[model samples]
Structures are given as C-alpha cells and as structure tokens.
Target: MFILKRQDVEISSIQHPKRKQNIPILTYQGQSFRLISVFSDHQQEEAKAFWRELTDHRGKACVLLEETDRFSIWGKVSLEQLRAEESSNSAVSTYTKACILVLQAVYIDVEDLLGGRQAGLFQKDITNLFEKLKFPQADSPKAVKHWLNVDPLSNSSVPAWEEHHLITLLQELYRLGKEYFGNTNFAQGVRDILQDMPANDQNQFIDWLNQSALGQLWQ
Candidate 1:
C-alpha cells in the first residue's frame, strides 16, 4: 500500500519473513514474502537512467517497472538472490493494467455510447459481472459505477483488478458492442481507438491485444 517511504527509498511490505526486520507486513496467498516499492520523482530520461543503474541491483530490493508522467514506480523485493526470470504475478497484472489503460483512453460517456435505454443494460452488465465474480466490492453500487466514470482527457489511476476481471470485462464490452450496437468489427474498432492513444500506451495495448482472445478477430 505504501508505495514510497522517503526520498527515493522504500520500505518492505510483506508479511512475516524468516528473519524479523523493522517493517510492516501482510500475508500474500498462504506464503508471505517481503516486498518493497520504490518511487522516483524524475522525468522519463532521468528515470530510465535510474532504472538502468538500479537494475544492476546486486543485493538491492527494487526494480523499475514504469515510466509515467513525472514519476516511475519500482517493485522493491527483498531477495538474497536477484533472479533474472520475470514474476508471473507481474506479467498477469500487466494485462489488467493495459486493459485499464484502454478503458481510460476511451473514457466513455455511457449516454453517448449506449444511449439511455442500452446504457441501463450496460450498467446491469457491469453489476452482474462483479457480482458473478464475487469481488469484495461486488455489492457496492459505487464500485460497479466506477468503471463507467472515466475522464477522457485525464490519466486516471487503474483499479487493482486481476487478469480474469479484466478479460471478462473486455469480453463483456465486446458482447455489448455486438449485441446492442451490432458493431461486429470489434478488432478494427480497437485499432481505431488506439490511434488516439499515446505511443507507449498504444504499444502496450497492442502487445496485450495480440495475446488476448479478442484480438484474434482481426489478426
């Protein structure tokens, strides 16, 4: 939760470690592994330099993962041996992040996309999606509405949704287009949407799309 500790430094944030250290903790899965999050308030170029240097890593516990706006976020892991292999958690989460990015890019005004009648159905679909998934916030009406409340011109924070949650949403969005609007050109529509996105986001979304089930339509 605490992404940053102090100026360019981050503290560990996992449950109990074999050896007790001076930091807070939370249980992950059934196994508790200590983790840290490093943050940098640097521009893209400087952040890249910092990332290159930090990744030399050695015994350090932070790896650069993003370069956005005026900050870069790094996942700081407390590992005795810095492994070269990527974590599955990070890889899976990237899909959710990219999907969130696409949603943010489109920033739909439900009224514009679905109109009054179909908009209600779209809302019902979202409610049902969360309820069926049994997400912690499934019962929260605001949580269901959160997905629809996007700002077209703003870069919003992404919800901490898992891969399944995002994939299902993408499927639902596709379904809504097909069923309600008769917009069968799903992949081309995505391509057109990306034409307006930032270069980095477009590339990231493309990578996710290429691997996603929905992207198969046009590819």
Candidate 2:
C-alpha cells in the first residue's frame, strides 16, 4: 500500500483545534504549503520506510506533510527546480541533506556550549544562520523545525545539501561562537562533539572544517 511520509514532533502544548480549523501552514522558500493526506498509522510507517529506501537508492522531491498528533506534526521539503526536473532535483537534494546534517550538528554543539543562557543572543545568531543560509523565514529553532519538517537535533529526515553549504555553516558558526562565547568556550564545544558528527563523515567533515576559511579551532 502507498502512504505519505511525515516527521514526528513534540510540543509542550497547543491551542485546542477549532471546530473549523485552518490547515497547518508551513512557509518554505517564500512559498506557503499545507500538504494533506489520510492513511492508517500502519500505512504511515510503511510509507516512511519506503522513503528511506528511495533516498538510499534514488533521491526524490519533498511533496507531503501530515498531522501525526496534537502538538506533534509531520513535514517534508525539496527544491523542485523552477520547472521540476527529477534527475537534477535528486542530485541537489542528496547534498542538501548533508548540509542539513551539518546544520543540526552545529546547532546541538552550540546549544550545549551555551548551557541555556543568553536566549536573546542565541536566538539572534541562529536567526542569522538561517538567513545566511538563505532558507527564508526560519528565524528561530521552531521556525527551522517547521520549514525542514524536522528538528535539528532529530535524525528522521534531511533536506538538500552541499559541501560549500556545510563550510559556510561551520565558518559562520565559528565566527558566532568566538564572538559570543570566546574562542575557548566555542572550541570546547567542538571538542565535545568530535567523536561523532555530520553522521559517519565526522573525520572528513572535521578535516574540511580545519581547512575552512575559519581554520581549525578546537584542534
């Protein structure tokens, strides 16, 4: 059976749904989307597994979103060219996911470094990172979660990616770390996550970071 893919989310609380509620809206790349689908929970799981197989064998575009539960939502995304070409979109999305993984890793690293202080500065830099990455209005973690249809710290899904995108993200992250918490604290955070990162590409990613415009910091 065919079913749509959706990412799971957890929320503290949500306003009760209106008897006639508007569709949940996700704004991405300057476009507004609210994908709707209906299938049994079992079928949903099967659908996700199918997507994983497709991603491993042949990349595809992000074209669906579904409501999983209260305060828990599902979403997906992909850059379908101005005219939607499968081959090119597939290649681009593959790399896009790698870049997103980099984004997720850095977010976790920096958040751990801050240790829950400086909400304003943290939000500011995160917002800047989203803007710098040119992802539209993902000016906060929540926004990022919504746009990517997954959380940064979560491992369920990834968007299109590229090596340069990873470099830009890390380089900017390094700058922000230094500017906000000093070289010592920022580098300390990098050291903390070196054992694993960017998924299995940790060593290569670290090497790329060390060679990036910012140069190696933790090492």
Candidate number achieving the greatest TM-score relative to the actual structure? 1
Local distance difference test scores for all models: 0.46, 0.43
Best by lDDT: 1
Q: State residue 20's C-alpha deviation in candidate 2, in Å.
A: 34
Worst 10 contiguous positions by lDDT, candidate 1: 29-38
Where model 1 places Cα greater than 4 Å from the true spot, the runs are 1-98, 101-110, 135-139, 152-156, 195-197
lDDT of 1 by residue, 164-203 (tens): 3555566545555566656555435565655655676666
Give me the displacement of residue 88 in model 2, in angstroms. Answer: 13
Query: Clashing residue pairs in candidate 2, if any?
Result: 95-161, 96-159, 96-160, 96-161, 97-159, 97-160, 97-161
Models 1 onward score TM values of 0.48, 0.40
Clashes of 2: 7
